[model samples]
Target: MSAVFEAMIRFGLRLAGSQFPVFIFPLLVFIVFRWRAMFSSVRENPAARLLLSYLLVVFVLRFVLYMSGYPYQGRYFHPITILTVFPIAGGLLLIGRYIEKFKRGNLLAWLVLAVVAASAGKVLNPPDPKKWLKDIPDAIRANAPADGRRTELISVVEDRRLPFYAKSGYHLLMPIFGDMFRDAEIFLADGASETGKKLKGKGASPLDLEGRKGGIKLIVRFDEPTKLRAIAFLWSLTPDKMKADVSFQTVEGGDFLKAELVSSNQEGVVFRQELTAKNIIIAIDVKSNSLWHLSTVRGHGFDSYQVFTQGYYNGMMKWLPEEDFKFGLQSVTQAADEWGGDNVFILFDATIPEVEKALEERRLRGKIMPVGEFTTHKGKPLSLYRGIAPDRRD
Candidate 1:
């Protein structure tokens, strides 16, 4: 109970800092400081007393309503002022009558109109944005099997435009692009990812152990014996409190191995280990009470792995051309495969030579197929590919 009250106090303080309703603040401050003098008419006038009661009841009711333990946020509270304004409006009209006896009424009316006009523009033109995966939703609806099959889109925007836009019966699996967009931004804008970072087996996002010191566990399984050379534990910003404990497992035997902390920063933590496991379980022990947002976790031993992401910030805020191709394609694919989704759409510019060469050599035929080609608005060659016969099994 005390904690909730404390939270409310903090909420009120934070909101007061904004000093909103720019036109009303001066009147409110005057009422607060000189309430007795301002409302002195109430003692002698019945109408004035009724107006005071109305204004006071609005706020008193709101106090009771807010204290009833509902979540308090800017969207929910403060609107009660609409009710409080009725009495204020009535009082203002009475004051207008007094001012009319002096000839200031027209000036007051014009001032009110100017204030309304100043605030009207922002209210009419609200700020909202649309997602960029246009035509992909319609494409899925047209081609997807009506037997209620699920298709995964390789898009990273936040709107869930792929899943939400699909008809009720149709199932769509799309990547959850929570601030992982920052990863793409960092890569394209600065190229600060681990210099020799190699893509290994794609795995699930790291699970919160719920303050359990037991560990963060990842199951790494492959057909043949693959030497676990490097394991990159993609983190959610702050991961220093957690320690790495890498282990290996095989049909013959299993052993726990020590993992070297290659590097650590806010983006993620990179750990390197030399171990062998056909099916291995690597666990990371987290310190208590720390929140870790694990966007992705995977092991790297192969030369390169398929990345899945929407090509770049093209439509809407089409500021960069072919800028985010590599980061988006690579990281998003890793998360998609882990989450039981197969990307059906892929696009790229001439920036990624490896993908271009792979396309030339038909190296990605079993996994993905080239679909179409076009030049970007900025005159960059853009090629589209669709994932083919994707393995969506658990």
Candidate 2:
């Protein structure tokens, strides 16, 4: 019953899309007026006809909701779409009975007017999915600490406009990007085999994992000693049945010992462990059968991969507000400092001006570097921001 209700709601939103209301309103009026004779057969006994009419009205209302991108149980709501349409649908249904006595031309004109009004109302308010995605990076960059040498860094990517099938497959790009930061150690959980292959074949330099399954590798470079932090920004908006895991490994030739699981949510998991040797590996595993096929088998240095999940400055802010951002940063920073480092490389997205401001304020300019652009699950380009600090020099 709940599922049916949910379905009904979703259907309404789908039907409320810009083009749908225009098409549906006229058809609805026509159905009501054209079927009046049929409807009137039991007008004296209106219970059956009324029930059918009510159901029809409910179906149409649900259709409008569906077209407007309002999912069943969606957290966000577009006020104009719902507030305006619901009343209109109800009023039209009520008027349909009275309008049956009017000329067909007048009824048609009324239908046209209702559609025009609905369209105008909807057009006046548009949902900004892009703006929402863009804000995440901005917030992260803003609160980023200026003392890049002392502050730890993490990056998150949130892209919601992806095709349903591609959503799970895109997380595979995380590790591929993680391999690029040479100044500090990094880890990524991605679900894209194509990205892994590209990273392995490119021979870019930072990634240097040999004889590893799933193209997992570690890049180590020398910089100032500092702290470390972890940030998880997810493009998979549907978090109901997702699991993420981050594991640390001590690479002894070819085998791995599970070190720690840092963070896990419906989207994925992140874990952090100290790397004492040059040969170490971090694996981010997203537990979803839908993503397993994207696993990679080889490792390489630098190659372009499809960014299923890319790190960005602005996008992180959307997921983590200022307070949470500070905490996550402090987590990595403290960890790096305890491990005896003056600098820690923080991987993030560059499009966020806030992150840049934070870094500048902390006087960590030399510590910051913009790596590359990552594509969202929708295939839009997102900037890659990285903060590089090592433990010994600072």
Candidate 3:
């Protein structure tokens, strides 16, 4: 019996698919039954009434369950079938009486009314399918790379959240050139002594230096002359105080000649020079005072603000140490009494102590509002403090 029922169900589904008109069969059945019930008197037959009532209960139950998040396997078929049954049962009860009264004339009018009612119900209540199916297809199409092509290599100084294609293998390309270009190889240094060791595995030539020092060195090669020009421009602009010596070298018969700078200076006068082995070392004494000065001037304003109080450090303003805050407050505050008002919002991450000391010194006055529970890029939690200074005007 179970096998036979399964076969019947498959046959019904197949028929519904092959014959589009069969989609309305449930609605048609509902209308026939409803018309019969409508024409029958309320007290005419108890058995008929009971059967109609049972069918009505089933229809209501189906509708309620479908709307209340009950999972139905066959799309909207369950709801539509249940709704059609209700209307058909009503029509069954009324159609017989109508047929006796107006015969064929009533058929056309009833059909138009039924269609309007069904369409209105459909519009007011719509079935919403799960979103994954639609969203997945669109996402796949949107993320497909241009022309379905991939770059061989990409480099970045820091790991930024980039597209999937760019993160496969990061090459650390330096911005010394006019434009950034990725070198096939990268050199890693521990201080400066081990720089040569890192390059030993790679086939590229190692850079020769006069003295080994605390700083690190990296060498990259470029194939094109334009690339070299960009590198030279970058080297010239590098801050001289950093004490980085960048020079270019030409390949001799079977070895490399000494490196030379692209530009040179004499007695404060700047002169452009072609990079050659002989005159390269002569430009080593040129000072990069202007570059260092610019960098220092740009960073001058960083120390202007200060924080105070250990409670503030523990709370939201944790980034500034309490001691540093004390120094900053002392530098900016005119009087000790200025620390009593609530007019400044000191923003800092956790782990600062200098700020707390300043609050103790009476350089800054204000209610300390501690804000903790913030995450930094390295996933460290910090706090912030906010309060207005006493003298500020609204």
Top candidate on TM-score is 1
Best by lDDT: 1
Model 1 segments more than 4 A misplaced? 1-10, 13-20, 23-27, 37-73, 78-103, 131-161, 166-366, 369-394
At residue 109, candidate 1 shows an lDDT of: 83
Clashes of 1: 6
Q: How many backbone clashes does candidate 2 have?
A: 75
Q: Which ten residues in a row have the lowest lDDT in candidate 3?
A: 282-291
Q: What's the CA error at residue 80 for candidate 1, in Å? A: 4.0
**Each prediction's TM-score versus the true structure:** 0.38, 0.26, 0.18
Candidate 2 vs candidate 3: which has greater lDDT? 2
Model 1 over residues 342-380: C-alpha lDDT tens digits?
A: 344544433345455654464432344445454433454
lDDT, candidate 3, 1-394, per-residue tens: 4433543464456434533242255446555565555447435977657656766686455444432222334544544455445555454435545565766455646655776677677768866653332332233234333444322111111222222323221122122231222222223333434323433221211122212233333433333444444344435433453323444433322221221232222211111112211112211111110111211112222133232221332243221222332333342332122433232222333333434554556634343433223444455333334333445523
Query: lDDT at 257 for candidate 2?
Result: 18
**For residue 318, what is the lDDT in candidate 2?**
14
Global Cα lDDT for candidate 2 = 0.35
C-alpha RMSD in Å of predicted model 1 compared with the true structure: 15.2
RMSD (Å) of each candidate, 1 decimal: 15.2, 17.7, 29.0
Candidates by TM-score, descending order: 1, 2, 3
Query: Local error of candidate 2 at 1, Å?
Result: 5.8
Q: How high is the lDDT of residue 48 in model 3?
A: 57
lDDT of 1: 0.37
Candidate rank order under lDDT: 1, 2, 3
